[model samples]
Target: MPQPSSARLHEFRIVSNDKIAQDIFSLVIEAPQLAKTIKPGQFMNFEVPGNAMSLLRIPLSFARADADAGTVEIWYAVVGDGTERLSRMKPGDTSTVLGPGGKGWGVPAECSRALLVGGGIGVPPLVPLAAELARAGIPFDVCLGAKTASELVGESELDALGAQTLSVATDDGTEGHCGFVTDLAAELLQQGGYDYVATCGPGVMMQKVAEAALAAGAYCEASLERMMSCGFGACSTCNVETTEGMKGACMCGPVFDASKVVVW
Candidate 1:
């Protein structure tokens, strides 16, 4: 596991807010200090003050990070009123950004190759992770899944990153493979060169991916999404059952060893 984030509060100016996919929008925030320390699979808690309905800070992971530009991007689907309100804010608007929170995914030094699996809204976090892999000279392949072609927003981004290979699976046959991304990843893992597998998405999807990795005798880690009232570990709302006992997703993880998580 990676070290816990050095959480801080900074007022960030919204740099850009643009629609990336069907219902998903990418929100870029300017926070030099926070941007420098953020890593893949890590998320920030935003305090959007204008709405009476948004009483708590919303958690969003880094879709991309530009430490040089002093900015980090979050890809969020407008699933609720909180995200809807965030989508309406202009580029010059400011919001309280508290972060560099949660444990992030890490690839072991011994591992030279990795497979990244993501689904639906869960696909955003994998972008930074894949970039890091590319930067480190550790070759990787990405397998993303969505209900249809329109929802695969990160495909172009991943293509631009020039990963070793890119694969997509949609529920309908509008894209690459017509199946779950886990199935694609499983097929690749079975080919036998990958050293590790990292995934994030729906709980059920991750569970199946975990099983496949384990069956193939490969190492695997998963980033989990849970309802969080407080971005820090103060509130126990984001607890997850693990092999050791109960662990808080806000602190202990949003990422964990696939073998440890007791997925239903």
Candidate 2:
């Protein structure tokens, strides 16, 4: 398991904030220290201004980090009050963030090839992971899912990163396959070349990916999502049930061995 990194408050200035897809927004923030230190699959807690009653910060995983440029990009959906407020922030907006939190993907050095599965908003974290795999010269295939074509994110980005193959699925047949991405994943796993698998998405999606990876005898890791009330382990709201017992998502994970996870 990868150890959690210490969290700290960093002041950030929004470089750009734009709507990229239906209900999805892309936010780029300039925070040099954080940009240099945050790892793929780890999350950050953003303190969005404008809400006094909503004291808890918004915990989000980054899509990409440009260390040299001193910027970090995040993709988020406006599903709630906090996110709605977040989407309204304009460029040059400033805020404080607590981050470099939680353990990230632990792909072994021996991994020759990888399969990445992501759905909807969960696709953000996997973008950086794909880049890492590509940097290491480990070929990877991607399976993406969304409700419709307009809502899909990261396919083009992942393809640009040199993914071996990119497959997409939509619930409504507005895009590639007209079923769950799990179906695509299962088909790919059946061919038997992947040595490692990583997924982030809806609980059911990750659960199915975990099952398929296990069947294929591939080492798999998943970025689990939970309501992280605190970006640290102080609040027990993000506990995850595993074979070993309970663990906090904010510290012990946002990523974990898929086989050991007992609850999605």
Top candidate, metric TM-score: 2
What C-alpha lDDT does candidate 1 achieve relative to the native structure?
Answer: 0.87
Tell me the TM-score of model 2: 0.98
Expressed as tens digits, the lDDT of each residue in 189-212 for candidate 1 is 888887788998999999988888
lDDT tens readout by residue for model 2, 1-264:
435457899999999999999999999999999999999999999999998899999999999999999999999999999999999999999999999899999999899999999999999999999999988999999999999999999989999999999999999999999999999999999999889999999999999999999999999999999998987888789999999899999999999999999999
Task: Name the lDDT of candidate 2.
Answer: 0.95
Q: Backbone collision count in every prediction?
A: 0, 0
Q: TM-scores, in order shown? A: 0.96, 0.98
Stretches off by above 4 angstroms in model 1 are 1-5
Q: What is the C-alpha lDDT of each candidate?
A: 0.87, 0.95
Q: Which stretches of candidate 2 lie over 4 Å from their true place?
A: 1-5
Q: List the residue pairs that clash in candidate 1.
A: none
